[model samples]
Target: MPTLTLENDVRQFLGSITRRERRFAAAGTLITLLVLVPVVAVADPGLVPGTPAQSATEQAVDAARGDSCRDTLPADTPDYVVCRWLTPPQDAAAVAAFWGADGGANLEQAQPLPAQYVRCNRKTDLSTSTTCKGGTTFCRQLPSGWYQCTDETNGKVTYERYVNGKKQVQSTPPPSPSTTTSSTTWPTSSPTPSSPDTASTPLPTPTPPDETLPPDGNPPDAGTPTTDPTTPSASVPTVTAEPTASTTPTTPEPGNGAADGDFIATAKKARLRIWLESDLADDYLAGDTAFTAALQQLVTDAKRTDVTGVKFADNLAYTGFSTEQQVIRFLNRATQALRAALPGKRLAIGVVVPELGCGDSQPCITGLRKRAPLVTKQHVNRYLRAGDVDRVEIAGGLFGRTYRQYQVTDPKTGKPTSITPALATRAQWMSVKALEWDTLAQIGVREYGLAHTGDTSPWTMAQATAQIEARIGTAIGLGASTITLWGHKATADGQTYRLLNAGLADNPTWNGLTGQGLRGRLAVVIDPTSTERGAADIVHYAKGVSEIFILI
Candidate 1:
């Protein structure tokens, strides 16, 4: 065994061993061949005293390939290139320990085997060997939420359980992925209460826009207004989104800022809030005339489309930080202008939390907690108390999954504090599962294939779809009323993989989840540019949750 030509050759040997071959090898020394190894043929039955001769077909079938299957296929096997269940050994230890205590199964003494010697069985499929026609066991789906796996060869039967769309031999339900429960009090604004029965209540649906909101809902204006509404004056410096000619309502109406008709009504009915960061201060920052024009255009567009909410936050779009007084002043002025533009509409102020990445040592969970609390107590709380805004929000970058299990280290001392997944989740900046909040639940989404995440493997369409579904579950499972799906159109070999705008509704996984009772309780984010696939998912998601947040 020339120490096996390659590492893959060793795995092939381990995967191909059969009980029958073991018996044959006992009668002789090692047989070596680069191609499929030939086995010993039985002698004539007439010459043997009590032996029965096997038919030609039986002999050929027995000699073809062993009926043994493994959790995965060996890399050197012929089908390894195309096998759907190809699972590469995770580490050197996994490869060395695969054969348990069989010390002789190492590379030096092992011979690589061909594909016909073994079959790859996926974790979901409980079916036995493909070649063992008569002796094979089959798993059948039953109505009782359990599977019946029957070994036809021995007439033996056993029950298996299906959990989270995967087949398992165990009977108990799987534990929650978070591995811990929180006793923290629920936020007052939580869409669903933390009670056990809270899942039963349907989330409140957004009222129809009375056929207004631009492209999707707004109706054309009847005519232009007789007078342009005056811009409201603010004690602090203010930059208002210039009112567009298209938005001036021809008729004067009353009720809920009806004079602001299409704009005010649309915002109220859709329950929308647009986040505007640093735009109010751009003129003061760099004297960028175009920047001011852009802000005006954004407001003008919102009014024309009947969008009502505009938020002001520092550090969202700008990299530099402004003084606390500057932020407060800007908020006051921006809110005044927004109220004047779209009277009776909601006004929100936001704070953009900065991301602290894994430095020389992992970030301590305690330190991470300090960050959120400091932001809330010092920055967000004071503004919320101002009583001028209808809503207060915090936005920031999410930590990638890779940091979840990193070794936590003290920021000042740079010493190891703890190296555990539980603590890491609590420490990560963007992981909602780890963070504890008092006033608001962060509504966000997740993505894969980005740098610095734990996941590094190339993604298949199936894997990507599964990931999106998992993210959806995690957000809703954590009591998120709204989820921001952060993803992009990724292409591999001419196929696209994405949660939004990637034609995912046609995917079987997406369609299967259609009526799983996810609607009303979960609001999903959608890209405004997703006119095709996203539109369909938005409609379905909105039908269930009552509203879809459009990412502009």
Candidate 2:
């Protein structure tokens, strides 16, 4: 018998395929089609008569699933998470509702499929799956008819959307930030100044500390969120307080009799310097109250001893102008303020990390401080020196804006290789985490993480856990003395604070107290008011504040 080549079979299938979708009776409460994927691995994809010339029906039928359908994530999956529709969904709502019902099992909720558009001229009707369109095809798409073909957009400032599984190419978006730089000028005109009023509201009681915190450092299941699972995204989230910029700092109200009282009570009085990035819902002042209150009241048998170093976060973000002088001024002012807050001796915790999301080519002082000079290793040293802030912190997404797609990256730099970006490319989400460390090291700043990033990172529990471990490894390699994990929105969600247990667990591999460590320096803190019964932080925000974060 003559040899039947793979190309010949693919050609024969494509040539005679009727493009009729098989119909089957619905058997389960949740519905989905049984999709058949074509074999696209043959070296010669040109076996068909023409590539892009295939009919829309053929294009839809020709779609290939480059990625496999997954429910449980692989162990190595890194920073981002990919949620797939197992099949080309017939009713997007049905799929959404089905997942929504099971929401908070992991993701915040089954989000209404979002509108992610691609600008490709070639077809992307079945974008959710890999298509036979080859490399020229727009590479990425969501089941919600969202797609991206930046290369083939033909220099037209238009974005493409797929509708009803049909290709509808061409719509205009404001020029991308990289093309025509968005204004970096300070916002005096659009100052919608408003302070959160919840600062004084006694924070919701946290889950009984014993039940939520595991002894070995695995985080709590990523099941909690600020919003009830059944609630719509629009309703106010289940929050006791969100500190607004104008709210005055108050003493930390007790949630429990100090989850770890004796150890903390005997500790010396910690004098710390705090630099307030007042714009970011004001999470830190509450942290300040929690820190002091813990110090004073949590002592064993009222044996409250004085402490030496206090936790003060120096997060300089949302400075809309790119200038050394501008950032320096903020540093000096913050230092002076903290110096006054604790008069004995100030322990400056200089945050040398991306507290805000960034886009490359943008100036550092530009609002959001995406990618620019001031935030770079070179200028960061000068700024740190100006503040005389010697302790370094490496964090992102703590206070300012929720980062966009271009702001986060998979940990291709570390081990176990367990991440894939769902919306953005690996390259697009650049992590300057190492750079943040380099800057701190250059200026002789105490380097590691403390109270930053979780609010800003667009990752799942595994990804966040992996990221913490990865950073600890990096910090250990750099001779870091301490590494801490603080989930800023801990009150709204429990996933980030779960890192506390993970941070405390010992890892012998890299001599790290945490995974990213060559040095064993790990610290975990949960905000006094934060609760484990809260909602998924990233997922809730991705749906609720849909405009700000481009859910990675």
Per-residue lDDT tens digits of candidate 1, residues 145-209?
34456665575666565344333565443334266332222234324213211223332222221
Candidates' TM-scores? 0.35, 0.31
lDDT of 1 at 263: 27
Candidate-wise lDDT, in order: 0.32, 0.30
Q: Which digits, one per residue and each the tens of the lDDT, describe model 2 over residues 217-322?
A: 1122222121111234322211112233332223234334532342232221121111111121123223565434433432221222243334333333322323
Local error of candidate 2 at residue 97 (angstroms): 65
The worst-scoring run of ten residues by lDDT in candidate 2 lies at 543-552
For all predictions, the C-alpha RMSD in Å is 26.0, 22.4
lDDT at residue 198 of model 1 (Cα atoms): 27
Model 2 segments more than 4 A misplaced: 1-263, 266-305, 319-327, 333-346, 350-382, 396-469, 478-481, 493-497, 500-519, 529-552
How does residue 346 of candidate 1 score in lDDT? 61
Clash pairs detected, candidate 1: 212-218, 213-218, 263-306, 402-454, 520-544, 520-545
TM-score of 1: 0.35
